[model samples]
Target: MKQELTELLCRKSFKYSEEPAFKLVSGRMSKFYVNCKPTTLDPRGMFLAGHLVFDAIRTANVTGVGGLTFGADPIAVAAAFASGLKDQPIQAFSIRKTRKDHGIVRWIEGDLTPGQRVAIIDDVATTGGSTIRAIERARSEGLDVVRAVVLVDRQEGGLENIREHVADVSAVITRDELVEQWTATARP
Candidate 1:
């Protein structure tokens, strides 16, 4: 499953160049770029990602899985769906980038409550800034963030950065893995 997903991402989402040509969210130029949405939104990609992420967090004893909105949304939902199929049953949640001003006035949307164990997930981790922000926000809302997961780690200190907030941090795929797969298949 991992191999299939790697290939799919290489073909559909990963891009590389001999020189640093891609601009990252952190405003740095990168030799490669990864936009997981194209892959995560696909049916097969979702299946593989769902199972992979579920496998990573299955033993964490988390009742919910989620992270900052947009990037983490699909992966969290997919993991939740996969968990249900596996009978582990973890719910999915989303953390808003901005606070809600109406009614509830909350940063999270889900069937979760304060103090429930949850895992923060994201599609990609570059500087790990977004994931860290999610962790902070979750903590502020009274959620217990026990674990963190990223679909793709840029291998640029992201995991290490996230470890400052949560000891348990992991990535389903790394920049090196994608680069290796991309290089292997790019040969004529």
Candidate 2:
């Protein structure tokens, strides 16, 4: 499954070049970019992602999974659904960038409750800002963020930065690994 997912990502989501290099959200130019939307939205990709995430966090004893909105939306939902299929049945949540002005003025959406262990996740980790923000909001609500996970880690020091606050952090695949795979397959 891991090999298959890596290949799919390399073929469908990963792109590389030296000239006119890709621009990252962090405002840096890069030789490659990974847009996980294609993979995360695909049925097989979504299945593999959920299972991989569930496998990573299942040992953490988390009751829920979530992260910053949009990027984490599909990931969290997929993990939650996969967990249910596995009979673990974890909940899913999303952290809003800004608290709603009306109603409960909540920062998190979904069935999350205070004092539950959760694994925060995102489609990709560049600077870890989104994951950190999600952690902040979750912690504010008294949720224990036991682990942080990303679909891909750019290995650009974001993981180290996040480790300053989070003890457990992981990425299913690293930028280096993807690059290696892409390089290997690029040649005839």
Candidate that scores best on lDDT: 1
**Collision pairs in model 2:** none
Q: Candidate 1, residues 157-176: lDDT per residue as tens digits?
A: 99999999999999999999
As a TM-score, model 2 comes out at: 0.95
lDDT of 2 by residue, 123-147 (tens): 8888888889999899998899999
* lDDT of each candidate versus the true structure: 0.95, 0.89
Candidate 1, superposed: residue stretches over 4 Å from native: none
Measured over all alpha carbons after superposition, the RMSD of each candidate to the real structure, in angstroms, is 0.7, 1.3
User: lDDT score, residue 153, model 2?
Assistant: 93
What clash count goes with each model? 0, 0
